[model samples]
Target: DTAVSQTPKYLVTQMGNDKSIKCEQNLGHDTMYWYKQDSKKFLKIMFSYNNKELIINETVPNRFSPKSPDKAHLNLHINSLELGDSAVYFCASSQQGSETQYFGPGTRLLVL
Candidate 1:
C-alpha cells in the first residue's frame, strides 16, 4: 500500500479556473502539509495542519485554501487560479514536531 497518495496526479486548466487536489496518508501521522514547487524548482510550504488545526504560511495567498477533514487527509483548493499558480503541488505527512516528512508523488498543475 502507498504510504501517501494524491488524486489526479496531472492537472491542466486555464487561468481563472478553480481546481482542487486531494491527499491522504496511511502512516497515521498527526501532521500534514502542502508545498508548491515553482518552475525554477524552488519549493516552499503553503499550509500545514496539526491535528486538524490550520497553520498557513504568511506568504501563501488567500486564493489558496487547505482543508483537513482528519489527521490523515488534506485537500487543497485554488480559486481563480492564475498563471503564476502553475507549479507542482506536493502533499506530505509527518509526526508532530518531526523534521522529516514523507511526500506524495505530487500533483502537477498547468494553468494556461
Candidate 2:
C-alpha cells in the first residue's frame, strides 16, 4: 500500500491556466507538506499543514495555495500558472515534528 499518493502524475497546460493537484496519505501522519523541485533540481518547501492548520513557507508565492480537507488529504492550487511554475511537485507526510518524511510519487507540471 502506498503511504502517499498524488493525482495527475503529469500536467501540461498553457501559461495563465489554473491547475490543482490532489494528495492523500495513509500513514496516519499529523503533518503534510508540499515541495517544488525546479528544473535545476533544487527542492524547496512550499507549504505545510499540521493537524489541518496551514503553514505557508515564506518563499512560496501567493499564487500557490495549499488546502487540507483532513489530516490525510492535502491539495495544491496554482493560479495564473506561469512558465516558472513548471516543476515536479512532491507531497510528503510525517509525524508532527518528525524529521523523517515519506514522499509521494510526485506530480510534474509543465506550463507551456
Candidate 3:
C-alpha cells in the first residue's frame, strides 16, 4: 500500500477559485502535516494534525484550511485562490514532532 498519497498530481485554476486537495497515508503514523514549497523551493510548515486535531503554523494564511478526516488523512482546502497560491503543496507524515517526515510526491497548483 502507498505510504502517503495526494490526489490530482497537478491542478490548474483561475484566480479567486476554490480547490481542495486530498491526502491519505497507509503508514499508521501518529502525526500528519502540510507543507508548502514555493517556487523558490523554500518549504514552510502549514499545518499539523494528530489524532484529528488541528495544529496550525502561524505563518499559514487563513485562505488555506486543513481538515483531517482521521489520523491517516489530512486534506487541504484553498479559498479564493490567487496567483500567489500557484505552488507545490505537499502532504507529509511523521511519527512525531522533529522526526523524519515522509512526504507525498506533491500537488502542483497553477492559478491563472
Candidate 4:
C-alpha cells in the first residue's frame, strides 16, 4: 500500500487560474509538509502542519495556502497561479521529532 498519495499527478493550467493538490498519508504520521521543486530542481518547504496545526510557514507568496483537515491529510491550494508557479509539488509526512519523511509521488504543475 502507498504510504502517501496525491491526486492529479499532473496538472496544466493557464496563468491566473486556481488549482489545488490533495495529499493523504496512511503512515499515521503526525506531521505533514508541502514542498516545491522549481525548474532548477531546488527543493524548499512551503508549509508544515503537525496535528492539524500550522507549525512552519516558509516565505512564500500569500497566493499559496496549505490546509490540513486531519493528521493524515494536507492539501495545497494556489490562487491566481502565475508562470512562476510551474513546478513539482511534493507532499511528505513524518513522525513528530523525526527527520525522516515519506514523500508522495509529486504533482507536476505547469502554468502557462
Candidate 5:
C-alpha cells in the first residue's frame, strides 16, 4: 500500500494562474506536511498540520494555502502563480511524536 500519494506528478502553467495539488496518506499518521524543494535542491517546510490543526508555518507566500480535510489528507492551493513558484512540492506524513516521515513522489510545478 502507498503510504503517501500526490496527484498530477507534472504540472505546467503560465504565470498568474492558479493550481492545486492533492495529497493523501494511508499510514494512519496524525501529522501531515508540505515541503518545497527549489531547483537548487534545497528543502524547506511550507506548512504542517496535526489532527487538522495548523502547527508549522514557514516563510511562504500568501498566495499559497494548505488545507487538510482530515489527518490523512493534506492539499495545497496556489494562486497567482509566478515563475518563482516553480519547484517540486512534496507531501509527507509522520506519526505523533515520531521523527521519521514518509514522503510522496512529489509534484513538479513549472510556471512558463
Candidate 6:
C-alpha cells in the first residue's frame, strides 16, 4: 500500500484559475508537509502541519493555502494561479521528530 498519495496526478489549467490537490498519508505520521519543485528541480517546503496544527509556513504567495482537516490529510488550494505556479507539488509525511519522510507521487501542474 502507498504510504502517501495525492489526487489529480496531473493538472492543466489556464492562468488565474483555481485548483486544489488532495493528500493523504496512511503511515500514521504526526507531521505532514507540502513541497514545490520548480522546473529547475529546486525543492522547497511550502507548509508544514503537525498534529493538525500549522507549524512551518514558508514565504509563498497568499494565493497558496494549505488546509489540514486532520492529522492524516493536508490539502493545498491555489487561487489565481499564475504561470509561475506551474510546478510539481509533492506531499510528504513523517513522524513528529523523525527525519524520514514519505512522499506521494507529485502532482504536476501546468498553468498556461
lDDT of each: 0.93, 0.94, 0.91, 0.96, 0.96, 0.97
Q: Write the per-residue lDDT of candidate 6 for residues 11-74, one digit (tens) a residue.
A: 9999999999999999999999999999999999999999999999999999998999999999
Between prediction 1 and prediction 4, the one with superior lDDT is 4
User: Model 6: how far is 71 from its true place, Å?
Assistant: 0.7
Evaluated at residue 58, the lDDT of candidate 2 is 50
Cα miss at 49, model 5 (Å)? 0.4
lDDT of 1 by residue, 4-109 (tens): 9998899999999999999999999999999999999988988889999996564888999889899999999999999999999999999987899999999999
Q: lDDT value for candidate 2?
A: 0.94
TM-score of 1: 0.96
lDDT of 2 by residue, 1-112 (tens): 9899999899999999989999999999999999999999988998989989986575888899889999999999999999999999999999986799999999999999
- The residue pairs in collision within model 4 are none
| Superposed Cα deviation of residue 86, candidate 6 (Å) | 0.3
lDDT of 3: 0.91
Residue ranges of candidate 1 with Cα displaced over 4 Å: none
With a 3 Å backbone cut-off (N, CA, C), the pairs that clash in candidate 2 are: none
Worst 10 residues of 4 by lDDT: 64-73
Please list the residue runs of candidate 5 whose C-alpha ends up more than 4 Å from where it truly belongs after superposition: none
Colliding pairs, model 1: none
Q: Please give, for residues 14-91, the per-residue lDDT of candidate 4 as tens digits.
A: 999999999999998999999999999998999999999999999999999889999999999999999999999999
